[model samples]
Target: MFEISDTQKIGVGLAGFGIFFLFLGMLLLFDKSLLALGNILFISGLACVIGLERTFRFFFQRHKVKASISFFGGIIIVLTGWPLVGMLFEMYGFVLLFSGFFPVAINFLRRVPVLGTFLNLPGISGVLDKLSGDSDRTRV
Candidate 1:
């Protein structure tokens, strides 16, 4: 079985709170302070969960350099009181950074009962497929 350390557990909680704050910030029309807090919490949580060295390695990898710049730049922008633009930059960086995992995530989601059914719908499935970069594959 896999073991999660106490620090990682705390990290998970912090990351969850970060995500909640991020959502709330958006709900409140992109409040700068909440977004900044979320960014700080999320980054710290990630470092705690994975270790500072690993986090640094992950972000600074050659192929991920641009993504790292965009993601951190977005955080800086948010801290400077440009929440909307910062969020947009972050979104782009996030998508570029995580696109490779989309197919795996989509496939996993397709197995969850209610969500699976909803995802299998024509329009939804098509959009998911496109986003996952699986649109070129012929489904059996």
Candidate 2:
């Protein structure tokens, strides 16, 4: 009894292809730069593979601001791959992308020693709240 939805099948295929290209680019490609392009493909494909409900939870829940930035960063990375900026974007995007899903880490990260200082900096929380659509309070 193996019945899978069309979307799930598509997701599995995209994820598989992404992983294959990633390995191929890293292990077989003549040019090392194809690795970055492969990474971009991998991230975008993974994004597409994730379901809307989980994606929404990741992007709009505890780490909405971080998730949004990472998703957009992934786009920018893909666009700028040829220009060499995509590599940097991909690295940063991956970090935030994963962080967006692990709710426990969000608060933990905010409480780290040096990192906490930066996280607590003025105006950041307000902007984050606004991005998350939390309208409990008014800002002047």
Candidate 3:
């Protein structure tokens, strides 16, 4: 029943992680002591950010208040947390890695069992179907 073009990709939030990894890689390239450790954090953070962005976009596109708040929240959080979060990735590797997976994990959950389909319903399908059906109804 699922169609290819009709299927949506889970949008990734790579920006946050990209920023985190970019900073971390810069930190690591500058300070080689953490080459191994930094690599892990970089990969994980990248996943988190890309995944986060996609998820946010998906839900954000749907609701009004939620979208507005999330849009503002992302800007505020990124602006405020940019330095702090970047540093966190640098100073605390594990925290950054965990941060990345947690969201992907949540999104992954929506792909499984009953709960997944229920929450991820495209929401617009039903409306479009109704409107397109028998446009002849409008014939005067």
Candidate 4:
């Protein structure tokens, strides 16, 4: 059992991680429902992931066709796997949603040519690479 003793969250990824832990810690501290808070945050994160991915692809891509196709494909993957986790292990659906959704979306963002390359400025590249693990040479 890993304990979150220190609350000093200092890093570029602080916003992303700190919020989750803050809520989790509070839940533990107050003896409140933790899985519920975790569930809500994860679900909200999943929705944000979908919205961000679609919006970025829509504005950046030449046409809507590709984005629609990709979005539907992502939907299929997330939806199909969700039920299986429930049946197999009483899993949290949002866990499947966020963990599966974010990686592909971030990878897609890093692959976008001009926009992605623009985002690769200095510290940002390291952040993106670390978040998505995309090693495509074009990004560098």
Candidate 5:
């Protein structure tokens, strides 16, 4: 069985709430306040979950400097107004930061009952394959 510490549990809750607020903010036409709150919560939660040192290491890694700058810059922009533009920058940063994990995420999603069925559809499957960089692998 896997064990989770108290701080990590709290971190998960904070991260979930952050995601919820982000969705709500977008739904409400990108409210700056909610988006900013979500950003803070998400970053703090990440630090809590991974430990502050690890979080710092992850963001400050040599290759990730640009992405970290973009992501943090977007947060600053959002705080200064211009939610939509800030979100665009954040999206770019997020994609760059997480691109390496896409393949693992895609493979995990492919195992979920409902999502797996939907993703297995010809068109969607092809797209997922390309996104995950699995296009070169033979598909059964």
Candidate 6:
């Protein structure tokens, strides 16, 4: 049986093509005239190769060290005249910071008086679950 889910098929196909494009892009990078195409292919391939879930988890998961590294790395890159790479690093840094901070903020708020009650409210809790993207739907 060669049965495959649509999601799996898409993911696999994208990954395959992504690898090819990524290599092609890297190879083409040596030619200044074709650098633009290389950049497009590289970015597209990278996006396809990683897929959204992994990318989201990379940014959203708890990773203080990685985030700090990215933030500072971006700064260093910018200083070295690589604005584009620096921008990417900075973007990752901001996302990592947000992801890392939100949970801490939520925990701190939970200890507050009125805010804690509001956070525990049924409607508010639902929103929190949605924001946190927890599939289990269980409460603490």
- Cα RMSD (angstroms) for every candidate in the order listed: 1.6, 10.8, 15.4, 14.0, 1.1, 15.2
Ten-residue stretch with the least lDDT total in model 4: 4-13
lDDT, candidate 1, 1-140, per-residue tens: 99999999999988888988899999999999999999889888998899999989988989999998999899999999899999999988878777788899999998899998999888898999888878875654
Structure candidate 4, residue pairs in collision? none
**lDDT for each residue of candidate 6 in 20-124, tens digit (9 for 90 to 100):** 643453475423223333334433443455666765565455656688578657656645666567657856875776674566677678669999888978888
TM-score of each candidate structure, all chains considered together: 0.91, 0.44, 0.20, 0.27, 0.95, 0.31
TM-score of 5: 0.95
Task: Give the number of the best model, judged by TM-score.
Answer: 5
Candidate 2 vs candidate 3: the TM-score winner is 2
Off by over 4 Å in 6: 1-3, 30-55, 64-140
| lDDT score at residue 66, model 1, on the 0-100 scale | 94
Pairs that clash in candidate 5: none
lDDT of 3 by residue, 93-124 (tens): 33332444555564566557887666445563
In model 1, residue pairs whose N, Cα or C atoms come closer than 3 Å (at least 3 residues apart or on different chains), thus clashing, are: none
Top lDDT hit? 5
Better of 1 and 6 by lDDT: 1
Worst 10 residues of 1 by lDDT: 131-140
lDDT of 1 at 102: 87
Residue 34 shift from truth in candidate 4, angstroms: 25
Question: Relative to the true structure, how large is the alpha-carbon lDDT of every model?
Answer: 0.90, 0.57, 0.42, 0.46, 0.91, 0.59
> What shift in Å separates residue 4 of candidate 5 from its native position after superposition?
1.0
The regions of model 5 sitting more than 4 angstroms off are none
TM-score of 4: 0.27
